[model samples]
Structures are given as C-alpha cells and as structure tokens.
Target: EAGVAQSPRYKIIEKRQSVAFWCNPISGHATLYWYQQILGQGPKLLIQFQNNGVVDDSQLPKDRFSAERLKGVDSTLKIQPAKLEDSAVYLCASSLRQGQGFYEQYFGPGTRLTVT
Candidate 1:
C-alpha cells in the first residue's frame, strides 16, 4: 500500500503571511488526520476527518487555521496571518478500521513551515 502524501515540502514565510498545505491519503483508508509538530514537542492533533466529514477539530485555532476534506479523498489546511510560533512540521496521517478496532496510522513526510 502507498503512504500518505503532502506537498510543498518546505515553506518560508514572514509572520502575518498566509500559507496553504495539501494532503492525500493512502487508498482504502477511512480516517484522515492533520497534526502540527513544533520543534522539541510531540505532534499535536489539529483536525481529523472521517470520509469527507469532520470527526474532530477541538484543537484547531479557528481564527488562524482551517482545514477540510470535502471529497473524502483529499484535504487541505490553511493558515492566515500566520504567527512565528506557528512554525512547525505539518503532518498528514491516515488509518484503516480493522474488524471492530482501528489500525495504526500511517504518516506523510510532512511540510515544514518557517515563519520569520
């Protein structure tokens, strides 16, 4: 099976600028996720989608970040007026449901964003 995919592997922007990131999950996966990993910290769940519908986004900053997976296959995340603290590696992950449980998630290479 293929792994999750993300683009614009690296981005450099000044604070207050806007940037967007894209993700494509592996085939047959039923659940997708977006996470932000700051340097020296563990990855933080930003949003989760279950087949084109949102399943969780309690940690997403509504005023600065947004994401969507409307087609159930691909998704996008955007940050407007980004802050310096927002510099981090944005990761995309996907997982499959097994029997009545869930499989471990597969992660993409991630896009590294640096805000100056």
Candidate 2:
C-alpha cells in the first residue's frame, strides 16, 4: 500500500501571509484527516473526513485556517494571515474507517511551517 504523501516538506513565511499544503492519502482508504502538531505537543486533529463528507472539524480555526477534501481522495489545508503561533507541523493521515477505535491511520512525514 502507498503511504501518505505531503508536499514542500518545509516552508517559511512572514506573519499575515498565506500558505497552503497538500496531501494525498493512501489508496483504498476511506477516511482522511489533517492534524497540527505544535512543538512539544501531541498532534491535534484539525479536520476529519469520511469519504466526501466531513466527519469532524471542531478543532479547526475558522478565522485563519481552512481545509477541504474534495472528491474524497486528496485534501488541502490553508492558513491565511498566518501568525507566529501557527508555526508547526501539518500532518495528513488516512484510515479505512470512521470510528475512533476501529481503524489505524498512516501518517505523512508532515509539512513544517515557520512564520517570521
């Protein structure tokens, strides 16, 4: 099976600017998720999708961050008017099911973003 794929392993942007990251989940998987990991903290789920429908997005910052998984195969996350606190690793993961304890997910290497 193919592993998760992410782009531009690292990025540096000035505060208040916008940045976007892309992800391609493994084939045959039905669920995809985007997570943010701040330094010294565990990954926090930003959004989760089951196929083409959104399963959860409670943790996503509506004012500055947005994400979408169109067509249920790939996804993208964007941070606009970036802030210094937004510097962290953005990870993409995929699984075979939606329930929390049902499926194991595979994670990407993650995109590290730095704000200046």
Candidate 3:
C-alpha cells in the first residue's frame, strides 16, 4: 500500500501571509488528522476528522488556522495571516478507524513552511 500524499513539500512566505496545504490520505481510511511539528518538538495535533466531520480541534489556533475534510478522503488546511510561530512542518495522517482501539496512522512527508 502506498503512503499518504502532501503537496508543495516546501514553502517560504512572509509573516502575515496566507497559505494553504493539501493532503490525500490512504484509501479506506476513515479518519484523518493534521499536525504541526515545530523544531525540536513532537508533532502537535491540530485537528482530526472522522468521515468529514470534526472529531477534535482543541489545539487548533482557530483564529488563524482552519481545516476541512469535505469527503473523508482528502482535506485542506489553511492559515490566514500566518505568524512566525507557525513556521513548522505540517503533517497529514490517516487511520482505518478512531476512538475504539489502537490504530496505526500513516503519515505523509509533510510540508515545511518557513515564515520569514
């Protein structure tokens, strides 16, 4: 099986600029997630979606970041007026299920965003 896919593996933008990232999860997966990995730290969950509905987003900076999984297969995350703190690797992951048992999440290579 192939892994999840993400676009624009690298991006450099000025602070306060807006950016969007695209992701396509593995086939048959019912849950998808977005994460932000800052330098020298573990990835932090930004949001999770189960079949196009949000499952959790408490960690997401709602005022600047937004994400959606319209059809449960693909998703997009957007940041408006991005901040310097937003400079990090944006990751996308997916699993066959969520909330019941342990499920392995397949992750993408991630999009590295640099806020200048």
Best by TM-score: 3
lDDT (Cα, tens digit) per residue for candidate 1, span 1-116: 77899998999999999999999999988788999999999999999888988888999999999999988998999999899999999999998842334479899999999999
Q: After superposition, how far is residue 71 of candidate 1 from its true place, in Å?
A: 0.5
Against the hidden true structure, what lDDT does model 3 obtain? 0.95
For candidate 2, what's the RMSD?
Answer: 0.9
Model 3 alpha-carbon drift over 4 Å, by segment:
none
Q: 11 in model 3: Cα distance from truth in Å?
A: 0.4
Could you tell me which 10 consecutive residues in candidate 1 have the lowest summed lDDT? 94-103
Model 3 agreement with the true structure over 12-95: per-residue lDDT tens digits? 999999999999999999999999999999999999999999999999999999999887799999999999999999999999
Q: Could you tally the backbone clashes for each prediction? A: 0, 0, 0
The runs of at least 3 residues in candidate 2 whose Cα sits more than 4 Å from the true structure, single-residue gaps closed, are: none
lDDT of each: 0.93, 0.94, 0.95
lDDT of 2 by residue, 15-34 (tens): 99999999999998989999
Instruction: Give me the displacement of residue 6 in model 3, in angstroms.
Output: 0.4
Q: Estimated TM-score per prediction?
A: 0.94, 0.96, 0.98
Q: At residue 85, give the lDDT of candidate 1.
A: 98
